[model samples]
Target: MTTPQDAIAARRKLTNRLIAGKDARRLAPFLASDVKVIAGDGSLILGAADVLAAFAGQFADPDFVAYVRTTTGVELDAEGARAAERGTWVGTWRTAGPQSGAYLAVWRKVTGQWLIESELFVTLG
Candidate 1:
């Protein structure tokens, strides 16, 4: 039997894989329709389509490397339908130095599947 923690972790793992492959279409299922994101550089990206657009631009850039997130902890709510995921993220570029950060993602079980509702990423280094 898989717990909420396990499910969310698995989803996150798949997310990382999709990102590494630059497959935004495959990454769509993991995000909510209204998914909101505060990028590491403090830019706000609202909605799944807009987020995917941002990713598409990055993926098209020749110098853009990859962004990987490593989940350090996950705290599920009492009902197990919602969770707070804390992780560290690193973005690499071909011409620029890497940027590392901490991120918090809010995941909600929607229609029996966990989806990312929102994310706040802060660059720490």
Candidate 2:
């Protein structure tokens, strides 16, 4: 059985994954099939594949620099099957300048794995 602590840890790993600015492959295990993402640009993206494609493009750019996420708070349900993670994300692109934002991710336990079901992020100037 997945404990609440394990769920929290999983969420941490997901943040670390983003911070590393690694390949989108690292996201597969943490994202649900129908996951919804509201990016800082205010664009709406749906599904794991679309999300992956978006990142692939982002990561492909050489100017796409560091990506980091810092979780300030996380709340898990009694059953530990659902959670909300709120944090800030800061990124740098070679020429686009810095993009920083606050994010809230709603996670769901799917197939015994805590996967991000929906995420919304807003850019901060």
Which numbered prediction scores highest in lDDT against the true structure?
A: 1
| lDDT scores of the candidates, listed in order | 0.92, 0.81
Model 1 Cα lDDT, one tens digit per residue, 1-125: 99888888888988888888887788889889999999988999999999999998899988888898999999999998899999999999999999999999999999999999999999999
Q: Candidate 1, 51: how far from true, in Å?
A: 0.6
| Model 1, position 22: C-alpha lDDT score | 86
For candidate 1, give the lDDT of residue 14: 83
Runs with alpha carbons beyond 4 Å of true place in candidate 1: none
- The candidate maximizing TM-score is 1
